[model samples]
Target: MALIILMLALQFYGVPHSSMFTFIFSGVSFEEILSRQIHLPILWVSYLIIPNFIILDAQRILSKTHLIQLRGFQYSHLQFELISLMGTLFITIIYVLFSFTWIIALMKMTHAQIFSFAGLKEMSSYFLFFLMILIGLICLVLIQATLNLFNSVLGIILPFSWIIFTSFTVWKFNPLNGLMLLRYSSYNTIQTFIFCFIIIIVLTTTFLTVVRKKDFI
Candidate 1:
């Protein structure tokens, strides 16, 4: 209900739809959709609720299966590292693909049509888009840190530092360019952001649960 209200308000404010972010397939353009303006409910259905469902399920699996927990070390365990590494790798690979394709999309949107090789410098105008990747990374660290803080204040100090790092990145960077997306395609970076965000959350939770099984004593 709250999400629906927020979505309606955003539409009233002309937020411009941002549902184009999908990780299922690569190299596909969103040109086929017939709806000029889609219902806001579609945004929640395609963008928010479904993906979070996956995260919730992933957490359940990790907790029950003990995928990340293992017997080793005093400060850290093999399971924790493995789980965190999974989160890191998931974020890294998605970031790489998003960074590459998003830049390509941005270049195609902002600058005139040019071969991929031609618009390298002008494309760099949006360094902040890349900064968005940190949004996912920092969010993962923050969740773990906050959890650790509840258990052991000292454990979360590093993750707390990430709050500062994320702030710094977001402070100087604002690349939403909401209008450009509607003009070019039926989507925006928010799709990419939310998709990646859920993945990071799953991995982070998995890592924390696995690692904490050992160090949580």
Candidate 2:
């Protein structure tokens, strides 16, 4: 099984291309990975080592918490715990990796200028990303409050409401301007900001609502 998994991972990571080291990502098949001219070393590290590190770290955290195995909880299961733990790890890797990736990219691109903003116009890209994550948290809280009070289908209503509210806010304030905060967080052009948003939301929600409240007996 380990050998098979390794083979599969080899397929997924593709291979490193040049000394520049820019083109490598997850894939499920050789054909899918073929689109990027990734070379051999990057392929091995990204596909096998990285995922193993993520899963192992997740497992360690879960072992420490042991919340799901607590006898008194009304909603606790090993399967659910495993999934949640994996989600936690995956989201962590995504945000941190993207953040560092962009930071380095910015450093390299701008020659390590030590980013600082002096404009009275709009927030810097890093600051904007921070604001965006904070706003998402605040909106999530407002959604939960609204759902609790008004008894709406929060799973559906919350996202729609967030979109509408964010749209209104964007149209009204126009703080971000034309500068995309997302650009700093991705190496590949195909990597979208939506993933970062999802990762941030998941991480924030889980930390605020779940892990903090869970009893680890």
Candidate 3:
């Protein structure tokens, strides 16, 4: 309900004349999508809300003992990681589709074409830019899952606090800045994607290590 309300408000009031691409990139031209240095509070808030759902989905996956203990279907820690990842991707995709649906509808009603990039190069760049953003979201989800496995309270408090803090700060020196898609122009798409991919790898290994070290009660 809250997400829907925010999406509607952002569409109508925030960057009403902008294109669907604005939600991902900050600049006016395709080339600047990865080089512009502007902050988008509306996009920031929308992206922040998504991680909360991802965390909840991670928690649900981690909490299910029956799913792990099914007869003849042994699930290892790697399997758990895969399941949680699938859940994260599913949640993120749903949010993206919903946002685009509302955006296209609003675009039609206003009879406006905010940003036009018809060239093959522009389309591919936009796709890569969008992929990097999704990778960041996946990082957050995996981080939440790993934290939850270590300690439940820290799992909830840490990720939520990070989101709250990042939303207010304009500092670029922050280590977790990759999660801030609005300012993604700080680094190119492939660079940020590689950085996020490394984070995911580390988190997955840590999660697996923790799961293996613990004794089942």
Candidate 4:
């Protein structure tokens, strides 16, 4: 509900939709602006809200179970991670669908050509971008889970700090030159995919190791 209101306010205030993409790229052309308008909502939701939700939920679950001992702790940890992944995926899909629908309505209002080949290409790229971010979010959540298990304070601080640092880097340095976790969001599709794949593998392995060694109580 708040997300919807924010979106409406942005639209009502005539915020340049492409302005969001400027954080990722140095300069965006007119055609790129159109493409961005079709996809920025998904990026907004994934970057701004999803990670916090996952981390908070992990914290809530941990708080409740800290004093309880399950017969199969390892299995329970795996299930928790799996459930988080599924929930994130489901939310991402629903948000993306809503974003697409909103974009279509805006296009119709402006009488933009909706069935054009270029539009279709942009939509395809949006889905690719969505997939990359989805994978990255999963990796992030797993890392958060591991941190939460090891040290709850660090778990909370690190993810929030990473996000703040990423935003600062995006504003202060050239995104192409800066090394940040979210730098991949502005990279080529293949590069983003490879980076996400590597991060997921490393984070998942580290999470499993940490969960196995750490005492839950």
TM-score of 4: 0.56
By TM-score, how accurate is candidate 2?
Answer: 0.27
lDDT for 159 in candidate 2 is 42
Q: Is candidate 2 or candidate 3 better by TM-score?
A: 3
lDDT (CA) for every model shown? 0.37, 0.36, 0.56, 0.48
Better of 3 and 4 by TM-score: 3
- In order of appearance, the predictions have TM-scores of 0.33, 0.27, 0.64, 0.56
Angstrom error at residue 204, model 1? 9.2
Q: Which ranges of candidate 3 are over 4 A from the true structure?
A: 1-16, 19-43, 54-81, 116-122, 170-191, 215-217
Cα lDDT tens digits, model 3, 1-217, are: 3355445545655444545444433322323334553343555545555665545645545546555464347665556555666776688766655654565566556544544532213445545545655676667667777777767667656666665555555544443454443445535444567777788889888877776675242
Per-residue lDDT tens digits for candidate 2, residues 1-217, read 2343334334434232211112222212223234553223333223223332333333334544875465445544444453554464455456445543554354344333333322212235445444443333333333333232233344335444433333223232221111122112323212323434554466456544543344342
- Residue-level lDDT tens digits of model 4 in 22-102: 232222223444455322323443344455554465544754675255434544655555555556556655654554455
Which candidate achieves the best lDDT against the true structure? 3
Error of 3 at 142 (Å): 0.6
Number of the candidate with higher lDDT, 3 or 4 = 3
Total clashing pairs for each candidate = 1, 4, 0, 0
Candidate 3 accuracy as TM-score = 0.64
Q: Evaluate model 2: give its lDDT.
A: 0.36
